[model samples]
Target: MTTAVISDSSSLIMVGKLKRLDLLANLFQQIVIPHRVATEIQAKEDGVASLILAHPLVSIAATTRHELLALLDGTLGHGEAEAIALADEHQMILLVDEKKARKAAKNMGLKIIGLLGVLLLNHRRTHITGQDAILMLEQVKAMGFRVSARLESDFMTRLHNPITHWHSPNTLK
Candidate 1:
C-alpha cells in the first residue's frame, strides 16, 4: 500500500457509488484527490453523501499551478484540469477515467490509470478476488465509467484467467 496517486472526482464518485472505497484505501498509501475534485463532487445532488474525504486514507490536495490549470481547463473540466495539474506537479500516477483527461495527462508524460486499472491493480495484488473483480467491472460499466466493449472483453478475459493476472510478488512493495 505504499503507492500514492492523485485522483479525479469521477473515480472517487464511481468507487463511492460502488461502495468499494475500501479498495482505494487498501491499494494506496495515501488517496489524494485534488481540492477541485472535492468541490466537484460536492456540487452533485444534495452534496456528497459519500463523504469519501472522511476516510482516514483519503486527503484533499491542492495544486499551485494556476496557469497550467487554466490552460487545461480550456479543454477539460475544472476538476479534471486541477487533478491533472496536481498529478503532474507531484509526479504521481493519476487515477482518471475521462478519455480527454487521460489523453492530456499522457501528452504531458504523466502516468494515468483508470478506475478499471485500479480494479486490475487490486486483482493483481489480491486485494480483490477474481469473481469480485468480474462483478465489480460489470457494475462499473453499468455505472457508466466509459468501458469500451473491447476493454470490457479484455478485462473479462483477464479476470477469468487469474493465473496470468498476478504481478510480480514485489508489486505491492
Candidate 2:
C-alpha cells in the first residue's frame, strides 16, 4: 500500500482543477492537509475546496513547530512550510507541486509526490489505463501545471514502455 499523504496547496489546486481528487482518495489511505494549506485553498473558487471539505478521508492538520516553520518561512510559502513541518511531525509523505518546496522537503528527508506522480500511481495500480493516464497528464500540463520538458517527455516515454516502466509508483521520487 502507498504511504499516508499530506498535501500542499499546489497539489490540491492542480488535482482539484482536474476534478480528480478522487484519484488521491483512492491512491492513499488518508490525506492530511496542513492548516495553512487549507487556509490558502479556502478562498479558491475551484472544485478542490468542496471536495476537500466533503471527503471523509481528508482532514486538516495544524503545524505546531513554529521554529521549523519560521526557518522555512522565507524559503517556502506558508502553506508549504506548514505542510512540510506537519509531514515531518507525523512522518507522512508529502504531496507537493512547487519545485522549490519539493526540493526543500526532499532536503529535509521527506518522501515526496506531486500531482503528476499521483496520476502515474493510478496508472501503475491499474486504476486507470495508460491512454487515460496520458490524457490526464496532458490535460494537467495544458492547464498550466509547469511541468519541465524533460519530465513531460519522460512520462510519455514511460507510459508507452510498460515492460520497462512497470515499477512501483513511489519511484516517482
Candidate 3:
C-alpha cells in the first residue's frame, strides 16, 4: 500500500465493471490519475466513477510536463497523454492497458503494467489462487475486455507455474 501508481482509464473501467476495483486498493497505496482519466471514468455513468472518486487512495493529479504532454496529445487520448506525462514527471510506475500507450510509456522509460499484470500480481501475492485467477480472466473476457488467445494461454501457463520461472512467457511486455 506504500507504492503509488499512475493509471489511465482503460484498466480502471474494465476492472471496475467487474466489481473488482478493490483489487487496485489492495495492490497500491495510492492510485494517482490525471483529471482527464477521471473525467472518462465518470462518463461511464456506472457506480464505478463514484466509488473510485470516493476511495481514500484515489487522487486526481495534474501533469506538469507540458512539452511532453503536448507531443503525446497529438496521438494519444487526453487521459493517456496526461498519465504518461505524470508518470514521466514523477518517475512512477504506470498501470495502463492499451498497447500503443504501453509502448509509448515504455519508450519514455516509464515502468508500465497492464490489467492482466494486475491479476498476475494478485495471484503472486496469494490474494487469489491460480484457479481464481483463471476464473477472473474468464470473467474479464466475458466482460468484453479483449484478450488474444495466445495471451490468455500464456497467462494460464504463468498462473499454473508461477514459481517455476518468473516472467517466462513475457505477456506483460
Global lDDT of each model? 0.79, 0.80, 0.82
The sequence of per-residue lDDT tens digits that candidate 3 reaches over residues 1-173 is: 43888999988887777778777877889999899999999898768898778878889999988999999999999999999999999988899888788779878778887887788888887888888778878887887788888877777787777764334232233
TM-score, predicted candidate 1 vs. hidden true structure:
0.87
Residue 59 in model 1: lDDT: 87
| Candidate with best TM-score | 3
Give the candidates in order of lDDT, highest first. 3, 2, 1
Q: Between which residue pairs do clashes occur in model 2?
A: none
Model with the higher TM-score, candidate 2 or 3: 3
- TM-score (all chains, Cα) for each model: 0.87, 0.89, 0.91
Off by over 4 Å in 3: 164-173
Between prediction 1 and prediction 3, the one with superior lDDT is 3
Per-residue lDDT of model 1, residues 11-60, tens digit only = 88888888788888777888898988888887787424356877777888
lDDT of 1 at 34: 90
Clashes of 3: 1
